[model samples]
Target: MNIVDFSKEEFQNQQIEASHLEEILKDFRRDGYVIFKDIFSKDYINELNADFIDKYGHLFSEEYKKNVFRVGHRRIQVSVELKKSFNTPYLYANPFILPVLEGIFNTEFIISDLTCVTSLPGAKYMPLHRDGAIFKGVALAPLLPAYAVGLLIPLIPFTKLNGPTRYWPGSHRSPLHSGAFEGNPNFIEPEIETGSCILMDYRIVHCGNPNQSDEKRPLLYCNYSLPWYFDSSNFRFDPHLIVDDNNYSDIPEEYKSLFQRRNMKLQ
Candidate 1:
């Protein structure tokens, strides 16, 4: 599949067009990934970056934070409450991103995991893998209508040296969905800026490339999935770490519908 590249001006000015969205969904379903370029606001990204540093500067020195940092891998554990520390309403209310989620679940979808990812220098290469549990026994091609999607928002400009995500264009349908499938020739290292978001199928074969740069690459990932689906497959969200708690008071009114707690009882 040919890559769809949108300029900053086009994405910011006329983003979310009906035709463009249809094509995006078409490509996403067929290729397991779609890239939107420079659609997010730089000011927003900068502000959030500053906010994270300000509220959590102490974390940069903590043992837990240091323990998680190694060659080719790094993460800020979910134990640190994020919804209360940084800006989340913007992500939830994003016009360019929300529609992509809508394309998958229409009116009834929710976030499975929202967490921070950082790849420090010497970070090891992560092999291709799924974000959630793969369905039982696949046959010819992989299944369609994946249960979830990963939305990656870079906090800084991404480059091969800084460690960008590597995705196999059409590997979502490969029969060996659960195995370590080789994607040497078909992989793409998309140079996404801080403003562009990478939307991908949860079933897509992808991984983080080793970060060879001196700077730590930071990104915010929101894994969106069906309201009924449980996301214990990856990082589990402890209730104590959740600041919003489904009250919908902190998040913008428009985006509250996108969040649902896993074990919460219905009214």
Candidate 2:
């Protein structure tokens, strides 16, 4: 159940697969962000989408969709099945993803939670904020590491027309300021192709852009973390338990650690 128990050879192989692992670590350490292109395949995305619809249909209901809003206009936030889907091997056990995470976090990690974000047409903009801020009120901050990374996997190509995520690179080192976005010119848009993944530092100042296109911008966001951190999702409702146990072992050891830690903490 503990991540620290993973074999050394397995961990080393993960590093080898993530050949650019050092570069990503450098980016995160210095700029607080990095991107990995085409981490998932089209077939993988399709499978996840089908699984989501089958297991959590209520999340796409009218009521849930109605409550999601953006700062400037109406917005839609799709249902996230963090715990329920965590046990899926395709998600947590991907060879490419686990190694990349290993390079970035450089520690025993776990799959904390995931969110399926579907930005409907006309969705409003999200305010600039850091993901770590979500844990500010919780007493678990000291027990956990300061960094929590979000792996943003776009199910559809994230282009300027679709309101892709934007961030001020290296801004994570600064304190959050109310006027940070006031005429500031450092922000840059990250254009991600379908199947590409972006690894972002939780402290980086970022926001979801509004989708101008007629089509919805769907994305899968998976969060990985060290064992002691707190999860924003209610782990008790996670759908991972419904999956067969054989599927669990197929996932990479790194992800297995993440899944185990979250389950242990919630239990």
The candidate scoring highest on TM-score is: 1
Name the regions of candidate 2 deviating beyond 4 angstroms: 1-19, 53-90, 134-146, 232-255, 261-267
> For residues 1-267, could you state the per-residue lDDT of candidate 2 as single tens digits?
000122356445643323344544666667767776555566767666666667654544567755543223444434354444345555655665666667666777766666666777777787776766544445553234345778778777789998988888776666545247645788778787755677776767888888899976767777777766665443433342222366655665644555564324343
Expressed as tens digits, the lDDT of each residue in 1-267 for candidate 1 is 335566566566755777877888888888988887666678877776676666554554546565542323553433224443354655754667777778876658777666667665667787667766555465733765767788788888899788788888777777665355663676788877777788888778888888888876777777778866765644542441244455446677666666556333222
Score residue 97 of candidate 1 by CA lDDT.
74
Residue 21 lDDT (model 1): 78
- What are the lDDT figures for the candidates, one per model? 0.67, 0.61
**Model 1 scores what on Cα lDDT?**
0.67
TM-score of each: 0.82, 0.72
lDDT of 1 at 40: 67
lDDT for 219 in candidate 2 is 72
